[model samples]
Target: MKSIVLFGAGNVATHLFRAISNTRNFRVVQVYNRTPANLVPFQTLVDTTSKMEEVKPADIYLIAVKDDAILPLVKELIFRQALVVHTAGAVSIDALENLDRKGIFYPLQTFSKTKKVDFKNIPICLEATNPQDLELLEELAGSISEKIFRINSEQRRSLHVAAVFVSNFVNYLYSEGEAICKENNIPFEILHPLILETAVKATGMSPLAAQTGPAKRNDTQVIQSHLELLTGDQQTIYSLITQSIQNLHGKEL
Candidate 1:
């Protein structure tokens, strides 16, 4: 069994730490976090060290820290060896400048403390400096996920950018919808079915192909009515997205 040491105690770290702790092939030998409170439950699950200087011997060290803090934290850890890795989509392996074996194990999915992620469906994008290390990463990734992709730093960056547009931007639209529903005194739950349906359709077809509603249908009267109901910020977003949708189908909507 290959032992693992994980850093950070945030959403990604918590999820990964639990998975590694449960898997028979792997053991979460140690967990480290800046705030001891954040690492509370994890400490009960496995050995934990709050200090970066208290480095533990492990086959792999998974750095799950934030993008901005990763470099500084790595420097603080003061550990010269061990297969070091980070879970950042846009960060390159060279970010671990002082380490020989380095790589990325980016899980291409949004994580929330309350949300349960299906590792089997979430693709693990991996890359490493050494061929042997890369093989080891693939093997490790396969343990947690059936869907794995060998994405280099550049491709990972591209994928991250697309993710921002799809997941993050789409979420902003949902929030806008909720606000509009609130202003109209309509229960936001009424839109839940439509939102779920839209997501489900996108799984089987491209977002473009799954497009529906007045925007896709070019129902000008419906569009204008909806726009009329919206005000200020929501109306601006509605207008922008509507124009984009019309451009999408190469026709006026």
Candidate 2:
């Protein structure tokens, strides 16, 4: 079995640990976090440590910390024989350039500690400077996920930006919709089916082709009515997005 030392106690780390644990070929031997309190959840399941010196030797040291902390944490880890990979989507493999066996084992999905997701469906993006190291990552990735892609740093970076637009930006828009509904004494649940269908449609076809609404239609009268209903901040955001949609569609009405 391949032993893994997972760094960070955040959402990604928590889900990764759970997923890997269910596999017979791999096991998380230890979990590390700078903060002792954050290591509490994994203490019972695996060896938990707050000190760098306490870290045990393993087949892989998977760093799942924030993007900013990746370089600093990698610099501290002195394992030359073991493969070291990070779970960051945007951060390049060069972040671990100092290490002998460096790679990326980025899972291309947003993780939540409370939300249980099937690893089988999630795309696990792998990259490595060495061929053997890449194969090792592929093997480890295959153990938990069926979807594995050998994406270069540049492609991975672009994918990360696209993910933010679809997931993070879309989530913010949902919050805005929810707020508007709440203000007008409408139950937010009424929008659930529309939200679900929109997501389903986008997955089945190109999002550009799936585009609809007053903005896509370039109905100025309807757009202006929407603007008038929104607050000053909401109007600015609505106008910006509307302009963007019309610009993409390249149609005048």
Candidate 3:
């Protein structure tokens, strides 16, 4: 079995530890975090440590920390022979350039410690400077997930930006929708079906082809009505998005 030392105790790390532990081919030897309190969750399940010196030798050192923390964390590791990979999406593999066996093992999905995700459905994006290391990552990825992609740093960076637009930006829009509903004394849950349907349709067909509503139809009367109902900040956001939709659909105003 391939032994792994996972760094970080965040959402991604928590999920990965669970998913990887389920597999028979790999085992997480230890979980490392700078803060001792953060290691509590893993202490009962695996070897947990707050010190870099206490880290045990492993076949793979999986760093699942924040993007900014990646480089600084890697510089502190003394293991040069083991394959070291990070779970960051935008950060390039160049961040680990100082190490011999360096790669990226980015999972393309939003993570939350409270939510359980099926790693089998989630896409694991892998990149490595060495061919053998890339194959090793593919093997490890396949152990937990069925979907795997060999993406270079440039492509991975672009994918990360696109993910932010789809996941992060769209979540912000959902919060705005909820706020509007709450202000009107309407149950935000009323929009649940519409939200699910929209998501399903977008996935099943081209989003442009699936497009509908006042913005896409350029229904100026309806658009004006929406703007009038919104707060100042919400009105600005509504106007901007409406204009963007119209522009994409080859319409103005």
Candidate 4:
């Protein structure tokens, strides 16, 4: 079994630990976090440490910390020969150039501590300098996930940007929609079916072909009416998206 050292207790760390711990191929030898309070739960299962120097020797040291904290933590780590990898989407592998063995192990999904996800379906993107390290990462990822890709740092960065548009931006739009629903004294649950169907359609077909709405139909009057109903930030967002959709379909309002 491959020994693993987890260095973060955040959302991604929690999910990754749960997935890997259940597998017989990998064993979490130790967990290290700056906050001793966060390491309390994992203490019962494995060795936990707050100090960087106390981290046990493992085959892989998976850094699941925030993007800004990665490099600083890498500087503090004393692991001389461990394969050090960061689980970040936007961060470049160059951030770990200081380490003897550096790589990336990014899970392309949004993680929430309260929500459970099936890692088997989540795409795990791996990047390494050599074939041996790459195969090592592939083995680790394949143990938990069926979807694995050998994505380079530059490709990973681009994929992260696209992810922001589909996941983060879409979630924000949902929040705005919920606010509008609350203001109108309507239950946001009413949009549940529409949201689910829209997602399904987009996934099944190209988003461009699956597009629907007044904007796509070039219904200028309806767009204008909808824009008028919105105010300030909402109006700006609505207008911008509407214009973009119209332009995409080669239509004008």
Q: For each candidate, give its TM-score against the true structure.
A: 0.92, 0.96, 0.97, 0.97
Tens-digit lDDT track of model 2 for 108-203: 998878988999999999999899999999999999999999999999999999999999999999999999999989999999999999999999
User: Candidate 1 residues 1-253, lDDT tens each?
Assistant: 9878898889899788766655667777899888888878876678888887786878888999899889988787666567888999878777887678888999988999878777777799999999988998888888888889999988888999999998999999999889778877999999999989888888888988777779888899998998888788888888888899989889874
- Which model is ahead, 1 or 3, in terms of TM-score? 3
Instruction: Tell how far residue 117 is off in model 3, in angstroms.
Output: 1.3
Residue pair clashes in candidate 4: none
Regions more than 4 Å wrong, model 4: none
> Cα deviation of 137 in candidate 4 (Å)?
0.5
lDDT of 4 by residue, 65-110 (tens): 9999999999898876899999999999999966768889999998
Every model's Cα RMSD, please?
A: 1.8, 1.2, 1.0, 1.0
Candidate 1: Cα lDDT at 15: 81
Tens digits of lDDT, candidate 3, 1-253: 9999999999999999999999999999999999999999898999999999989899999999989999889989977789999999989999996788999999999888998999999999999999999999999999999999999999998999999999999999999999989988999999999999999999999998988999998899999988888878889999999999988999989
Kindly report the root-mean-square deviation of model 1 from the true structure over all alpha carbons.
1.8
> Model 3: which ten-residue window has the lowest total lDDT?
225-234
Q: Any runs in candidate 2 off by more than 4 Å, and if so which? A: none
| Stretch of 10 with least lDDT, candidate 4 | 95-104
